[model samples]
Target: MESVRTCVGCRARASRSSLLRVVAIDSALIPDERAAIPGRGAWVHPTLECAETAIRRRAFVRALRVSGSPDAQTLIDHLQRNG
Candidate 1:
């Protein structure tokens, strides 16, 4: 059976494959396409709206359990580039 993950932004449970796995890189959020990055990861949909929502609500830091604010530009840029 496939694993299910929850989206920090939308707060919806979804298949792991349907959500994008993001990890902190230098305190900034980055997409882990292969979901192989180390450390804590926060899941979100591959869309700018979700990314923005996550940032606005500080979901990344809460979900990843990191200190301070985590940058979301890299993830936003990534979603924009690939969108």
Candidate 2:
């Protein structure tokens, strides 16, 4: 069976392959396309809407259990280029 995860933006459950896994690295949000990163990861849909929502709502900080604001610009650029 496919693993399931909840999107931090929309708060919806989806198949692991259907969502993107993001990890926090020293206040930077990094997208883990392979989902092989070793750390606490937050799942979000690979869409601008979901990404923006998560950013606007400061979901990444909470989901990743980070101490400060994480730079999501890389994630935005990534989604724009590959989304």
Candidate 3:
């Protein structure tokens, strides 16, 4: 059986292996490619639109229960850098 996680943006359930896992660290958003980060994590589809929605809606903050927000550019940068 595949592990399933809910997308913070669209609330869609997806296989954990298929979704991109993002973790908040040092007050910044970091991509957890290994999904081994020991902190609050938010899931999103591996698409720019989903990432944009998550940022625009503050879904990451809500899912992570964080008070402050991370810069969306940082997230896009990370995605670009990693991809």
Q: How many clashes show up in model 2?
A: 0
Q: Worst lDDT window (10 residues) for model 2?
A: 67-76
Residue-by-residue lDDT tens digits, candidate 3, 5-61: 988778799999878998877667777878898988999877777888888899988
Writing each residue's lDDT as its tens digit, candidate 2 over 1-83 gives 99999999999999999999999887889999999999999999999999999999999988889987888888999999998
TM-score ranking of the models: 2, 1, 3
Q: Which TM-score value belongs to model 1?
A: 0.94
> What tens-digit string does per-residue lDDT give for candidate 1 at 8-82?
999999999999999988888889999999989999999899888999999999888888988777898999999
For each candidate, what is the lDDT?
0.91, 0.93, 0.82
Off by over 4 Å in 1: none
Q: What does the lDDT read for residue 40 in candidate 2?
A: 97
TM-scores of the models, in the order given = 0.94, 0.96, 0.86
Winning candidate number (lDDT): 2
Q: Number of the top candidate by TM-score?
A: 2
